[model samples]
Target chain A: MPHLRWARALGASALLAVLLASAACGGGAQPSSGGNSSGLQVIKIATQSPLSGDESVQGIALKNGAALKLKQEYDQFKAMGFDLQLDPQDDKGDPNTGVANAQKLAADSQVLAVVGHLDSGVMIPSEAQYHAAQLPIVSPANTNPNVTSQYKYPEISRICGRDDVQGPVGAIFAKDQLGVKTVFVIDNITAYGTGVANAFKQKAQEIGLQVVGSQSIDKSETDYSNVLTQIQQVKPDLVYYGGLYQGFALMLNQAAVRGIHTKWMGPDGVFSNGLVATAKENAIGVYATSVAAPTNLTPGGQKFIQDYTAEYKENPDPYAIYGYDAMGVVLQGLKDAIQKNGGKLPTRAQVRDAIRAITDYQGALVKVGFDSIGDNIYAGYYVYQITSANASTTGDAKLMAQYNPKGELVSQ
Target chain B: MSSTLQTLPQLVLDGLVVGFVYALIAVGYTMVYGVLKLINFAHGDVFMVGAFVGTEVLRALTAGGRPLSPWALLLAAVVAAAAVTALLGAGIERVAYRPLRQAPTLILLVSAIGVSFLLEDLVRLVESIHLGKFVLPVPTVFATVYRIHVAGLQNPLTIRLNSIVVVVASILMMVGLTLFVGRTRPGKAMRAVAEDRTTAALQGIDVNAIIALTFLVGSGMGGAAGALFATQYTLVTPYMGFDIGIKAFTAAVVGGIGNIPGAFLGGILLGVLEQVGGGFIGTKFQNVVAFAILVLVLVLLPSGLLGERVQEGA
Candidate 1:
């Protein structure tokens, strides 16, 4: 019995040591409490995605984008009464991390308004804390409708379109634009993936497009040759992948190798230039729908792109645009709240109210916006076609297409 | 069916390319196992350290505003990584394995786990910030030169110059190793030590020198694998070792523990199996296939593919 107890204690100690070491080595995974330092007005903003393992690209983009915006706007922010600063944390794209980050942010009094929890999985767990704290969080990229759709409180919001809008648009384009009727739908079997795929399939079925096959693949998968072969035999004209760019890119490349000639369509996860770079020629004819305008083509997007390129010397990722715009919205709301509260920095509740009260605020990309469910009210999606001429073309198909519910091309 | 068949050649070709890289990693695992009769779990991290060391060396060369040629950079990377890895491996053995020399098997294994944790933490502590994080930047060999292609496919199968170098260097190292082990005095001492450590010590073989040499050789292989793996995969993170380590261990076990030839065979077979499984099943279960093969092989032939006889007394 003593031996057994000793062994158990040793195992526990070893495990504890490992976790503590991991935390120390990976940077302190501590919950930030807004320390009321005498001179520094420390404000924390956070975004969550898979930061540690795979899907790290998207997470990195989200983090850098938000950080860049905060850095750029810091001088102007300090000129005002509040000494604005930004604190970013990693969620590692897990819901557990999302919850932890959210709780941490909520607990910190300096965190007035938050920027992200990129994946819907992370957002779902963190939103409850944000709601209870009345801390407004604007998701730059999360597309799942449940993110804000069924929220008990409306403090949580997103700048991106819901999967309901984006998914249907993708399905309509495949059926109408690409002449892909008998189609297969494949989700990555996550909240975001399944949600978008379901919406696409439902809309496609309604439009007389036969949903011939549907399946789920784990997110970490890099090959889809076997599934592609099965789909090839089914002779589907298209395969709808409701996953992020990482899995989607691999799937397309492998499918191309397997000679699966079907057109591939996905939502915003396939929007990154990194996705295009990885997929290469395999990504040709692939399509993804975005609720917001493409950053390269947006009105002020060109300026942001030039500024970002000059600053980072790397091309500004699309998600960065949303993040920049998200910070702009929060700043605008905070400004309004500060003015309303007689030049004093408003309480967390006042800031949350200011965000809710926002209307017709012009932003960097478009007007600053939110609806009842905290989704963008002016929901417009852009359809991009990857073609032999390269998806980054200056042609008709490459131009953002506006689509209505019935699959007719609306005037862009 | 015809299209899928056409795709097979391309898939297999790429699979073999990846397999060669895996074989490089498996060699280190097998080498350590051969002499120590203990799996150096930290071998994969040694590969990671090599990549990091290469990064530091290349970055220094480029930082002086004199961008070295790809060949120069590659040479610098190889030498720097080899030196760093050799030191790291030796240090790890001295700190973690030395104390456990007469301990139980479980303690040695535990020490290996501790070493892995320690190395990971060390890397992470140095690369704390994400912005200036350690990135294993590969030379533009893949993008610029030695692009492979099939006539029909639109996408050219890109086999990078660096990858070719990696394969060539690995082969040379293996050949050198075989020659050294077979023909050199220290090599024979190493073999003798593996056969019977007490007897080798009685025959006037410097036990400490041989042990240090074992680490040097094993970690040197790991370093080469690291540079090659980084060049081929095009991404290197501190935690990258854990997954690759598991794969390499599986390769070593499948080939036969403590058998150098078996490790090579095992790695190639594992890589081919992964690609074939992906082609047949889907990419999602690619990891499952590797482990499944390990289990199957262990059940049927515990001695591994090379059929090496195991002596109980070390």
Candidate 2:
């Protein structure tokens, strides 16, 4: 009994230590007011993303994009008499962690604006804290419609199209372009996946495509042969999956093994090089829709891709350009605020207002401007097909068609 | 066949294939519990380590588009994973568990959980340093070369060659394990130690050696399961072991903890129930059904279907 008591004490103490350490890390705010004698004040632009765990590949790409943009503008900003710094935080793709990161960023007085919280689930919970702190936040990747819905957090904005807009595009494309009459829809049961899949299913039914079967799969599940078997029975012409890359890869690989060769389509969640790498040859012919056009399409996009590749020595992922543009929006807002305030350091509130007032700003990915509710007015979705399944190349996702916010497919 | 009947064969096949993998991993949990009365929570991470080892080996052998047979690559992967994980299991026991063998059960369990986290983070750190990322795709040596379709089914009921290989290899391993436990001297010593460590030691059996051997065998099976799992899934991540480990542990409990045959039966039952229930009911409730079965089994039959009643204070 005494030994048991001692063991319990040790375990409890160890757990308490871990909790305390994490709390200290999450809640600590460094004093940022120690200015250099040269009268230049340090201002931080924090970026939040999952820098660890399964989705770190996408998050790291986002971080690299922001860091590259800051590097390019660091000296130019310094020349304008402001010491600019980028403080990147890892939210681990978790809502709790994202909230903690938001609190930490909000506590820092010098942090003017934020660049991310890539996932919508993370953004949904954490945006309120930033709103309360009056810190303007822009996301390059968050696509859930409710993230910037009317009457919600007006301080939050994203360059990406909402899932409600993007999901219907996939359904319409499958119905019109691919000519698939019947489809099986699957979701991973997460908030984002469920929302996207529901939108797709609703649109498919509305457009007269038979919704043969719909199923929810746990994201942790690697095997889906049983569900695939059920799908084969329905004999759907196409399968629409609403989940991230890992689940998509697993389902695609397992479906291939089961010889269920129906055409596969997914939303922006599956638009990543990681999917092709994981799914390999099975990824061939799979279709996905994204919130931004390909980096090779426009001249600005082409230059951004070339510079990003040369700097990072790797091709940028789909969300990388969004990260670059998100940072650009913040920097442009800061410049505008400074110019309006006669070369003095503007307050956080002024920066937030400046970001909201911006119009007709050109980004590397698109001509970006925020409308009411902080949503990108020009943001739309594009359809892509995996032409090749090579891991080394830029995912080999060739752009097949583009769809505007109205769900009309446009020829480039 | 009607649509309802058409799905039956495919569901059963799917369940059985996954069941075999779970059964293999569950054996490790059951065997370790049998000897030490301690749950090696790190067993799952050992399985993950096996998967990574298998992936690295296959990648190295097949680099530069080398032409190697699929069977050969699979064999090499399984063997390498098993060998490495066997060493890792023994090392974990020596460093983390053996020191606290005389300690309270709480201490042993806590140590196990600590080791589990340590191993997972350790793998993540090492992989990040070496491969620049924690998640890596396992290269498949052989595609799904053959598909078996059942006749008389209106909707095609197809099974891949990899599924057949997984099932057959699992059966062979189970049979070999049964023979080893039944006939071999070391295996008999292991059983004796499990029955009563003090008495087995007094009767001249090497208690420590038998315990070590139990860990080696159990961890080796876990490694083999991991290798097979990677081959089927075609992706490996540092966190993959946790979910599967919990499921397999649940399988061990449902079948009657500390019973090898019970673990096997429990795994198959859980797998079949999950697949069939998910197919019929809602897929969101698949995990719920599996855990509900565990609870019902524990409540109704405390000793499990095949497990013996535990003699308190034996």
B-chain TM-score of model 1: 0.91
Write model 2 residue lDDT over A155-189, tens digit each, in one string: 78787898998999999889888999999999987
Best by TM-score: 2
Worst 10 residues of 1 chain A by lDDT: A388-397
| Candidate 2, pairs of clashing residues | none
Question: Candidate 1, B63: how far from true, in Å?
Answer: 13
lDDT of each: 0.72, 0.85
Docking class of 1: incorrect
Runs in model 2 deviating more than 4 A are A1-40, A392-395, B312-314
Q: How do the residues B58-115 of candidate 1 rate in per-residue lDDT, one tens digit apiece?
A: 6667676656677777777777888889888988887678767888767888888887
**Which candidate wins on DockQ?**
2
How far out, in Å, is residue A207 in model 2?
1.7
Say which docking band candidate 2 falls in.
acceptable
